[model samples]
Target: MKKIDWYFDFISPFSYLQGELLHTLPAEVEIRYKPVLFAGLLNHWDNKGPAEIAPKRTWTFEHCAWLACKHGIPMTMPPHHPFNPLPLLRLAIALGSSPEVVQRLFRWVWREGRVPTDEIYWQALLKEFDATPEMLDAPGVKQQLRANGEAAIAAGVFGVPTAVVDNRCFWGLDSTDMLIAWLRDDPFFSSEQLRQAQQLPQGVHRKT
Candidate 1:
């Protein structure tokens, strides 16, 4: 079975939408979540920061709402964002190999809009996984997460919810359906062709 590498940022609205329904992988498919630093990409592209990008931000909110409606997951604009994706990203990298924990945290934050910075929130997020909050802020977690972010850049990912299947980069949440199909080798899901012809809002960075 091929593993789907999910490089995601909790701060990404699209990723929030994708994450909610993303777990329905077939028995042969496995998801590997890499909590990546979206801030670094924003800084690199010189794009409008997540908060300032009005169109992207608004689109993110609406897109999430639409996906929530479709998936039956309750989602709302987070109370706060432009969150330090650092800690969360580190948790992903530190536990980079653990899909169980990654899926748990992803659902907690996106489905519930829970920010990990709050100790209680972290506790609640990790409870299902039998993990604890203190391990997140352990010394060097932030720095290590930063290194992972650098690795994301090296991997040619410029945005959230990147799914890399065997070194191929699917750089958007919208592409997950294709990612899934590809992993399954479902003729109906031609990931390679979709990657070639992905119709995305290009040339415009999520408008602010």
Candidate 2:
């Protein structure tokens, strides 16, 4: 089976949406979920999130709602836009509960509009998985998350909901279609195509 690396951060609603659509991938493909720090990547790229800017921030909220509706996924914006998702991410990683508990977390935050602050809520969330809060403070859990972030940066992933199949990266939730299409190709991109693509001048950086 072809292995695909799915890099994401829960802070991104797009990532949550993409999780819902993973079933669309070919059955022959195996997805490896990687939880990375979104903020870490943004800081490395010196980029600002959509919510950090004006007009775009407003558009982002509207767009998130529209996208969720379009995808037919239940969504209600979390009370906090950019709250710390480290605990959530770490818990998922420590438990090795990808696409299940992770999916639940997405729904819990976006669909249920809950921040999960109370210990009772968290215990309830992880009850089925048999995960304990002690796992959050477990040694190397934080380091592992950091390593995932650095590895993502090394792999040219600057955003969440990125799918990497055989070292080719497809970014953003909307790119899932294209990523699946790439997987079906008998022959991937030609060597000449890559050469021509890389030789082209870099794109103009837009001011935020």
Candidate 3:
């Protein structure tokens, strides 16, 4: 399977947008949603953290609102971001199958703008999926999620919505389609060097 590592933050609208966009991929392309602390990655990258991530935050809400309407996916981001996604990341990791959680979280945060901190929001969000908070907060699962997060960082991801197709990192949901185009278009891999190049976060790695 050609694995696409999807690095995303629950708070990121682009990540949310990308989650929705992912539905367009052909089933042959296996996608692995690797939840990472984008905030932490920003802190590690530079001094201006929020200021940098803020635009991404803004971009996600605006574009995704339109995309949701276009794709028939409900989306709303106002008042406050749905929740501190770190916990949800942990939950996804714990679940060991974050596709459903990632999909659901994107809906609640992007489509509803409900913060994850709100117990009521969680209840409502999980209810839609026929799930309960207990599913996300299962025993021994949180610690495992943390480990998965650490593994993402170790893999050299510095931000959310980073997709790796053939180890070529594509950041943001906007780039997702392009990434798929490259993946599906056999001509893209014309050169062996291009195919074998290392693709990691910009500062730490190169996109040769």
Best candidate, lDDT:
2
Instruction: List lDDT for all candidates, in order.
Output: 0.69, 0.83, 0.69
Clashing residue pairs, candidate 2? none
Candidate 1 residues 89-198, lDDT tens each? 66665564376666666666766777867777776656755555566676666666666678778777788878777777877767776676667667854557655666
Instruction: Give lDDT tens digits, candidate 3, residues 163-204.
Output: 877756777666766787777875756766665654533556
Tell me the spans in candidate 1 whose CA falls farther than 4 Å from its real position. Answer: 92-97, 117-134, 137-140, 184-208
- TM-score of candidate 3 on Cα atoms, chains taken together: 0.72
Q: After superposition, how far is residue 52 of candidate 1 from its true place, in Å?
A: 2.4
The model with the greater lDDT, 1 or 3, is 1
Better of 1 and 2 by lDDT: 2
Which lDDT tens digits does candidate 2 get at residues 51-170?
789899889888989998988888888777778888888987897746777788778878878665755666788786687778877877878888888889889998888998888789
Q: What order do candidates take by lDDT, descending?
A: 2, 1, 3
lDDT of 2 at 193: 73
* Per-structure clash totals for the candidates: 3, 0, 10
